[model samples]
Target: MILLQINQVARLFGAEVLFENMQLEIQSQSRIGLVGRNGAGKSTLLKIIAGIESPDKGTLTKTKNLSIGYLAQNSGLNSDTTVWNEMLDAFTAVRQMESRLRELETLISTQEIDSPEGQRVLKEYDQLQHTFVEQNGYSYENEIRSILHGFQFDATFYQQKVQDLSGGQRTRLALAKMLLQKPELLILDEPTNHLDIQTLAWLENYLQNYQGALLIVSHDRYFLDKVVTEIYEIARHKMMHYKGNYSRYLTLKEEQLALDWKAFEKQQGQINKLEDFVARNLARASTTKRAQSRRKQLEKMERMERPQGAEKSANILFKIDKPSGNVVLQLEDGEIGYDKHVLAKNITLDIRRKDAIALVGPNGIGKSTLLKSILKEIPLLKGTLHYGTNVSLGYYDQGQQKLQPQKTILKELWDEHPTTPEVEIRSVLGSFLFSGEDVEKTIGLLSGGEKARVALAKLAMNHENFLILDEPTNHLDIDSKEVLENALIDFEGTILFVSHDRYFINRIATKVIELSPEKSTLYLGDYDYYMEKKQEEAELLALLEQDQVKEKSVSAGKQSFQQTKEQQKIIRQLQRKIGQLEENLEQIEEEVSQLELQMTQPDNLNNHFALIELQTTIDEKTIQQETLYEEWEKASLELEQLDS
Candidate 1:
C-alpha cells in the first residue's frame, strides 16, 4: 500500500527556488536513501514530505491516519524526564489501553456474571486485553531494554535525566525512541551523526528489519549501502530516483548520464542538419517547398536539454616535501586523558613510513586525546613517546579551532606562506573550492565545510611528511569526501587519522587500531578486515569462556583416557540439547502459523473475542519461538566448540 505521495512538490527559500516539481511515492516497506551535496535542499525536501513545512507549490498526499517520525540533524531529546521514562512515552497508547483494561476488569468482577453490565464489562475487558497483548504491552519493557542497549545506554543510565546526558547520548536516545515508536513512515535527516562505529552497526541491523518505510538523508555511503534499497538524489534543482543501494546508484547514475548525453547529442545533430537545410535551401527556387517543410518540422520537434555532468568537488592533493624515517613515531605504554584522569592505559603504537592508519573506538574512549598527546598539545599521563628523525608533522583538528576567525579565507593560507605570490595562494584556495569573492569570506562567516576546506588547503601547503587528523570527514559532503580520500590515498606520507566513516577508512587505511579502555588492538588491513578479525576474536573468547566453565564443573584432572570419554559424553549431551531446542522452535513456529491463519478467517475477523484470542495466542507462541531460537543457538554453539 502507498503510505505517502509527493506530487509536483516545490519549495523556496527567500527568492531562490530550492527544488520544484519533485515527485515521489513511498510504499509501505520502501527503504529510500536521499542523497545530495550540501545546500542541494535534501533536508528541505524531507521537511516538505514530513508535513513539518508546506511546499511553496504543488501538494503532498498521505494515507489517512498515517504516522510519521522525523529526526532532524543533531536534534536530540530535550525532555527533563529520566531516560527510562522518556522511552516509556513511546507506548502512551498502549499504556492508556492498559489502564482501560484494568478499569474494565474491576467493573466485571464487581457485577453479576449474567447481568447486561457485567457482560459488557467482560467483553470490553477481553477486547482491551487482546489489544494490549497485540501492542506488546507485556514485552515493551524488554523491547526498550534491547534498543537502549543497542544504543550503548546501560541500565545505569535508566534514572539519569535526558537533559543531563551528553549531546551525542541524547541524540542516540532520540533515535532509540523513534525506533520504538515505529511510525508508518520514518524520515531521518543525518541519523548517523554522532554515532560510533559499533552503534552504527547496531542501527543498520535494526533498520534493515524495520516494519515501516524509511526515508533517510545521510552522507554515510557505507550506511546508505547497508540500510537502503533505493536512492533518490537531488541535484541542480532536480530529484532523480535510482533503484539500488548507494554503490549501485553510482554505477547506474553514471550509465544513465552517458545514455542521456548520447540522446541529447543525437537530437542536436538532427537539429543542426534541419537548420542547415532550411537556411541554405530557403532561398533556392527548386528546394524552397522542401526547406519550408523542414522548417515546420524543426518548429514542431521536441528538444532534449543538455545532460548535467558531475558537480564540482574540492581539488584536494597531499604531497610530501621530504621523506620521513622508516620508523615515523612510537609510543610505549601510554595513558591518555585530561588532567590526572586517564581514560585509557597500556596504549602502544608504531607508525611506519607510508602507512595510512585509522584510529577507532567507542565514544569517550580518548581517540582524540591520544592524538593530542602525540601532537604535544597535552601530555600523556604515562609512558614515553618518540618521533623519528627528519619527521615533519601536520595536524587537522576536528573542531577547526586552529583557524583564526578574524582572518579572511585568502589570508588564512596566504599569511602562513608570505613568500608565495597572492595569485598562487588564491589558486591553492581555488583548488579547495574557494574562488574569486569566496576567497574574501571571513573565516568566522564560513560554514563547517568551508572551514574544513580552508584547513585542508593550509595543511597541503605545509607539505609535511606525516599527517595527523581528527574526524577529517566530519562536515564534508560525499563528493568532497571521495576527493579527500583519493588525495590521501595518493599522498606520499604517513597518516594516522580518526574517523567514524567506515567507507573512508576502507578506502584510505592500510591498518586499523581499535582503542579500548585497557589496551589497543591492531588489525593488519582496512575496515572490513578489521571487522572480520573482531568477529573471530569474539568467537574465540566465547569458546574460551565455555572451556573455563567446563573446567570448573570437573572436580579434578582425570587420566587422558577418562577425560576423552567425558569430553565425548559432554559433546553428545550438547548435540541432544541442540536437537531438542530445534524441535521446540519448529513446533512453536507451526503453532504461530496456525494462529495467524485463524486470524485471517472471516469467522474470527467478525468475532472480536475470537480474533483477540487468536492474536494473544499468536503473541505467546512468538515469544516461545524466540526463546527456543536463543536456546538452540546456544546449544549449537556449545556443540560446535566441543567438536572443534
Candidate 2:
C-alpha cells in the first residue's frame, strides 16, 4: 500500500523556489535515501514529507492513521525525565494494556470460577494477553535494552537524566527512542551525525531488518548503501528518483546523464540543420515553399533542453612544501587522556612519510584525544611523541576551533598567508565556493560546511608535509567528501586522521589503527580489509578454543576423548543444520521482499488478482520463515550448550 503520496510538491524560501513538480510515492516498506549537495533543500523536502513544515505550493496525502517519526539532523532529545522513562513513553499504549491485564487478573482472583463475572474477567484477560504479546509488551523492556546497548548506552545510563547527557549522547537517545516507537513511517534527516563506525554498523543492521518504511537523508554512503534500496536526488531545484542503492544509483545516474547528453546533442544538430536550411532558402524564390515548410517544422518541434552538468564541488588539494623524513611521526607507549584520566594507553604508532592512516575507535574512546596529545595541545600523560625532520603538521579541527570567529572568510585565509597576493587568496577561496559576497561573511555566522571549507583553505595554504585531522568530513556533503577523498588520495604528505566515515576511510587510508583501552591493533589495509582481517582473527580464535577443548578432552583419557569427539561431531552437525536453516530463511525473506515490491507497482495495484496472488505468496513465505526461525533457534541453542 502507498503510505504517502506527494504530488507536484513545491517548496520555497522567500523568493527562491527550492523544488517544484516533485512527485514521490512511499510504499508500506520502501527504503529511500535522500541525497544532494549541501544547501540544495534536501532537508526542506524531508520536512515537507514529514509534515513538520508545509510546502509553499503542493499537497501531501497520507494514509489514514499513519504514524510518522521524524528525527531532524542533530536534533537531540531534551527532557527532564530519565532515559528509561523517556523510552518507556514510546510503549505507553502497550503498558496501558498490561495495566488492564493486571486489573482483570485481580477481578478474576476475587470471584468464583463458575460465575459469569469470573468467566468474563478470564476472557478479558485472555484477549488483553493476546494483544499484549502481539504488541511485544512482554519483551519490550528487553527490546529497549538491546537497542540502547547497540547505541552504547548501558544499564548504568538508564537512570541518568536526559539533560545530563552530552549533546551527542542526547541525539543518539532521540534516535533510540524513535526506533523503539516503531512508527509506520520513519523519516530521518542526517541520522548518522555524531555516530561512530561501530554505531553506524549497528544502525545499518537494525534498519535493514526494520519493518516500517525508511526515508533517510545521510551523507554516509556506506550506510545508505546498506540501509536504503532507492535513491532520491535533489539537484538544481528538482528531485529525481532512481531505483537501487547508492553505488547502483551512481552507475544509473551516470548512464542517464550520458544518454540525456546524447539525445540533447542529436536534437541540437537537427535544430541547427533546420535553421540553416530555412535561412538559406527563405529568400530564394525557387525554394520558398520548402523553406516555409521547414520553418513550420521548426516552430512545431519540441526542443530538447540542454543536459545539466555536474554540480560544483570544492577543489581541495593537499600539497607538501618539501619532503619529510622517512618516519613522519612516532609515539611510544603513549598514554593519552585529560590530566590523570586516561582514555587509551599502551599506544604505539609509527607513521611513515606517505602513509594515510585512519584512527578508529568507539565514540569517546579517545581518537580525538590522541590527536590532541600528538599535537601537544595537551601533554601526553605517560609517553614520548616525536615528529621527524622537515615535517610541517597542519591540523584540521572537527570543531572548527582553530578558526577566528570574528574574522571574515577572506581574512581567515589571507591572515594565514599574509605574503600571498590578495587576488591569489580570493582565487583559492573561490575554488572552495566562497566567491563574491560570501567571502565577507564572518566565520561565526557561517554554516558548518562553510567553516569546513575555510579550514580546508587554510590547510591548503600551509602546504604541510604531515596532516593531523579529526573528523575532517563531519560537515561536508557527499560531493565535497568525494572531492576531499580524491585530494587526500593524491596528497604526498603523511596523514593520520580520525573519521567515522567508512567510505572515506576505504578511499583514502592505506592502513587502519584500531584503538582500545586494552591495546591497539594495526591493520595493513583500508577499512574493508581491516574488517576482513578482524573476522578472520575471530574465526581463528574460535578454532583455537575448539582445539584447546579437544586437547583438554585428550588429557582426560582415551575413552573421555572419544566421547568428547562424538559430542563435537554432533555440535558440528547441529551448527551446519542451523546454518542451512538460516540460509533458507534468508532466501524466503528475499522472495517475500520481491513479492511485496511487485505488489506496490502501479500495474499490480490496479490488478486485484495480481495483488492478492503476490500477497498470498508473501504470506506463505512469512509462515515458512517463522518455522525456519524456530528450527534455527533450537539448533543454535543445542550448539551453544554443546560448545559450552
Candidate 3:
C-alpha cells in the first residue's frame, strides 16, 4: 500500500547541492513531518514529490491513480468567487452527478408511464442518486460548514468574495478546500503560519483522524508532536528517518551523533598510531619488512569521516546597560486601536522589573496593536500608559519594518551604532550567521529568517532595559527559536512581546496576558499554566450550566405535578356532578310516565281543568328533564377532556 517511493533523489542549485541521493517512502496513511533549517530545500523536496519540480537526478515511483494535494507556504486561493461557492467547487463530481440526475428526472416525467424509455430514465436516475449518496453529496455542505468553523471562517465570511480576503485568510481557504478534496496524499508547508492556538489545536485533532497520508513541513514543534508519527530530517545534504514525534527525534538524534563522534575518534586514533609506527621504523633494516606491512595496512584501511554536527544557529544575547525601576510599565484602563475603532478596552497591566510577559489572542484581536500603543507609535483611544524612570526601550517588529530595505546587512547594524569599530560590527554580524558575502547582501533580498536574524543583531547592540516585541518568532527555525528563547530567558530586562509560538512562550515567558476585544486577563505563569487555568475555568462554567439546567428541570417537574393534581380534582368534581344529573333525569322520566298514564284514564279525560293541570305538570317535568340532560352533557364533556 505504498503511495510513493523516492530513490537516489538529488537536487542542485547551480554548483551548490541542496540534497543528494535522498531516499524516502510514503506509505498509505503515513504521518510524516519534514524538518530542517531555512534554505535547506524542505519546500523544494515537497515540490519534487508533488511534481511541481523535477529532481536533477532521481527516480520517483507512485502507485497507479495516486492523488496528491500540495499547499506551499503562504500559498493562497486566487478565486474571484465567494467563499461558499469556492468551497462548493471542491465537489465538482458530486455537482455533475446531481445535474445528470435532474436531467434524467425530467426525461422520466416526459415519457409514458411504465414505458421502456421511462423505465430506462428511472434506472439512470437511480444509479446517479446512488453515486451522489456514495460521494456524500447530501452532507457535503455540512462538511464544508464544519471545516469553515474549524478554520474560524464564520457565516459572515461565507458571502465575502475570496478576492477581498487577506493573504492569511486565502491560505486558510486553500487548506479548507484541500481537506474537502480528500486527496490520497496531502502535503502542507508551514500550514500553521496563519493559524492561532485554538485553530492549530483543532487542525491537529482533525489531521490525527485524517484518512489520507500527510507530509507536513513546519517549524512548530508542538504541532509536529501532536500530528506526525515519524520525522524525516533533512540535514547535511542527506535524509535521515526517525520513528517517533519531534521530541523523541531530538533525543534519538543526540544519541546517534554521540555514537558517530565516538566511532570517528576511535578510527582517528588507530590511523595516528599506524602512521607513527611507519614513520619511526621505515628506515631501520630489521623492521623494514614490518614497516612495509604496516604501510600497506594503512593504505588498505577504510577511513571514517568526521561526523557533521548540527547546523549553525544564530547566537542571540540580550543585555541591558542599566537597570530599570521596580515598576517597569503600568497601564490603567488602556484602550488600543486605530482611528476611533477600539480593538481592546478595559486593559490594565502592571509589568514589574525582569518580567517576561507573553501576549496571546486570536488573529486580528490586536495583540500587535497593543504593543504599538505601548511604544506610542499609535495614539491610544483612551486611558494612560506610564513608563518607569530610566527605562530605555528596544522594539523588535516581527514585520522587520525597522530595517531599511536599501541598506546592507552590515550597514543596517553599523548605522545603528556608528561608534562601534568595523571589526566589532563584523564580529556581531558573524555571531548572527551573517559572514563574508552574506553581510553585503541587502535587507530586501534576504529571506524572512535572514531578516529576522539581522533585526536581532541590531537589537543585541542596543543597550535597553525594556524590550517590546511582536511575533518575534514568526519565521525562525526551531533551532534559532530555541536560541532566542534561551537568550530571552537569560536577559535581565523586562519584556512584553506578542507571539503565537506556544512552545517559545512556554519556554521564555514568566507571565501570560490573554487579550480579547472586550478586555484582557492575566495569568501568573507560562503558556502551559495558562492553558491549565483556562481549562479549569471552562470546566467550572460547564458545571454551572449543568446546575442551572438541573434547577430548571426540578422547577418544571414541581409545576407539572401541581397542574396534574388540579386537573384530577376538577375531574373528580365533574364525575360527581354527572352522577347527580343522571339520577335527576331518571326521576323526571318516571314523573312524566305517571302523568301520561293518568291522562289516559277515563276520569281524568272528563274534566278539562284537571286535564290542563296534568298537561302543565307533564310539561314542567319535561322542561326539567331537558335542563338536566343539557347539564349532564356539558359535565361529561368536561370530564372527558380532563381525562384526555
> Which candidate tops TM-score?
1
lDDT of 1 by residue, 1-644 (tens): 99999988888879998888798999999999999999899988999888888889988998999999999999999999999999999999998986786566456557885888877776676567667767777567769989998999976799999999999899999999999999999999999999999999999999999999999999999999999999999988888999999999999999999999999999999999999999999999999999999999999999898998899888988888889889999999999998799899989999999999999999999999999999999999999999998999999999999899999999888889999999999889889989999999999998888899999999999999999999999989999999999999999999999999999999999999999987898899999999999999889878975564433333345548688778878976886787788788678767766776676576765565565466567667767866776677677777766654
Q: RMSD to native for every prediction?
A: 6.3, 9.8, 20.6
Candidate 3 Cα misplacement greater than 4 A, ranges: 103-130, 273-297, 549-644
Clashing pairs for model 3 are: none
Top candidate by lDDT? 1
Consecutive 10-residue window with the lowest summed lDDT within model 2: 548-557
| Clashes per model (N, Cα, C within 3 A) | 0, 0, 0
TM-score of 1: 0.86
lDDT string for model 3 (234-262, tens) is 98889999999999999999999999999
Worst 10 residues of 1 by lDDT: 548-557
Better of 2 and 3 by TM-score: 2
Candidate 3 C-alpha error for residue 278, in Å: 5.2
Query: All candidates' TM-scores?
Result: 0.86, 0.84, 0.82
lDDT of each: 0.89, 0.87, 0.88
Q: Could you tell which candidate, 1 or 2, scores higher by lDDT?
A: 1
